[model samples]
Target: MSDKNREGKRTARERMLAERAEDEARGRRRKKLIVGGVALAVIAAAVVTGVVVQDQRSKPETPAAAPAGTIGDKNLIVPVGSDNAPSVLTVYEDPRCPACGIFEREFSPTISQLEDAGKIFTNYHIVSFIDRAVPGKGSKYAANALGCAQDAGHFRDYHDVLYRNQPDETNDAFGDKAVLINLGRQVDGLVTPSFEACVNDLEFSGWVSAVQQDFDKSNFKSTPTVLLNGQPIYPKFNNEEITPANLVKWVDAANQGKQVGTPGTHGQSPAPTSTASEPNNPSPKAG
Candidate 1:
């Protein structure tokens, strides 16, 4: 071939080689992209599956259907201890309050002992204000369940179990009505169909509102409010650390005409005209 013709052929050959190389590069890039996309999709699917499984595992057990029985009226006063006890101990508590949970854990045993000993008549006023603060209003359902348990004559047991299993303050662990009924299982003969109906229907939710109204009328603030014989237990309000020992001493002193640490924000004196009564009212808002 002539030199010009040879040059032309060489140039064509070079062009073909370059095109082939480019096509291979493109193919490699496409294959890498396809593999990367598939890997990303698998990882995403695994993440979603893991989340679903974790959620299922974390869910509380479903409650069983129980027999029906009387669940009492809307009076939130579930009294324990002797009617003839020398002193009456009234406590206002919210199921979802962490501080209330702390008090229940640390001090309720002593109060129970005092009640059993006939030293004091214990009255529990279950409230639901924490529901206003936390999501799902679990406090309302828990308090309503308390009333149902009261009718079953196992309020204290149910109350204790609830505090023992108290969920995080911000979380609405009690939102599921089933958990409340499940808790009733802890107290034999406590979780009846009537009780279940009461809880599922928010039966004592009205009573919870009443309890809040009474709390408002009493001019007392906060959960776990303890009043001995109508006198506010100052330590609970005064921010003083309370222990079972101190609580015993306070009761002894009150029995002996002495005042425990002077009332903090709500002052104390010769027991004011007794206004302790069953709760009743409409819904309450968060403070």
Candidate 2:
């Protein structure tokens, strides 16, 4: 064997080893590039997700739509009777409340009479807090139906009918939209397609929520919180029992020198400057 031939074989072996090392280094570089690219893509996705979440958090909520002819702050008041009446009667009530049903049964007739005579007008703030307290949607559904009736120009009639046929507080019968629509049949011209759709679609549900929010913010906490010219008058007025006759007497006394307001087409009225006084009994009760 010659020395030169042995040296050539050794050099060839060294060249093959050098080539293998170069290939391995290139493979490591490629792996690092791929990992770095994936890391960048993940970081970009996280940043985009963060931006979207922040934007959603900062966005303002859309305001609720109010019923037709609603007046007062936040358009929460549902006005019934003559808008021209001299005295204002503010009533805070939940439709599913038993105490409110009793109040309506007792005073509805007199209140209707007074409204017809142009003596006073009523501002109804219908709330749905009962739905939150109870596990039913009766309060919200009933209130929404009332809004539908108001739109149909039969608010007073439908309002009276609901109370007259009100179910037990725990029954949640009014939660059924069909029941509400059937009750609308009692009110003439109140069962039109629009009214039915409103009832079924829960059109005024948002408005009911707004009214409940307003009620929560107000001084009164219970249902059937009645006020006459900003003074608490349910159960009693000026320490006198609130019989139908006594209610007349209280109005008469309030309007002793003032002339009775003329009756006009039913509609919304301006917001009163004075706030309602807190009721003596915060708990709800029938008359």
lDDT per residue for candidate 1 within 1-287, as digits (tens), equals: 99999999999999999999999999999999999999999876543321111111111222232112211133335676554456767777778877678788988789877776656666676666654434577877887777777656677778899999999776787988998888778877777788788888876555566665555555545666677666566355245445788778767765675222322111001222233432232222211
Q: What is the lDDT of residue 268 in candidate 1?
A: 9
Q: Over all chains combined, what TM-score does candidate 2 have?
A: 0.72
In candidate 1 the C-alpha lDDT for residue 138 amounts to 86
lDDT of 1 at 202: 73
Please give the CA lDDT of all the candidate structures: 0.63, 0.75
How many clashing residue pairs, candidate 1? 2
lDDT of 2 by residue, 95-195 (tens): 87877888899999998888878888788888776666455889889999998887667788899999999997768899999999999898777899999
Runs in model 2 deviating more than 4 A are 1-63, 266-287
Clashing residue pairs, candidate 2? Answer: none
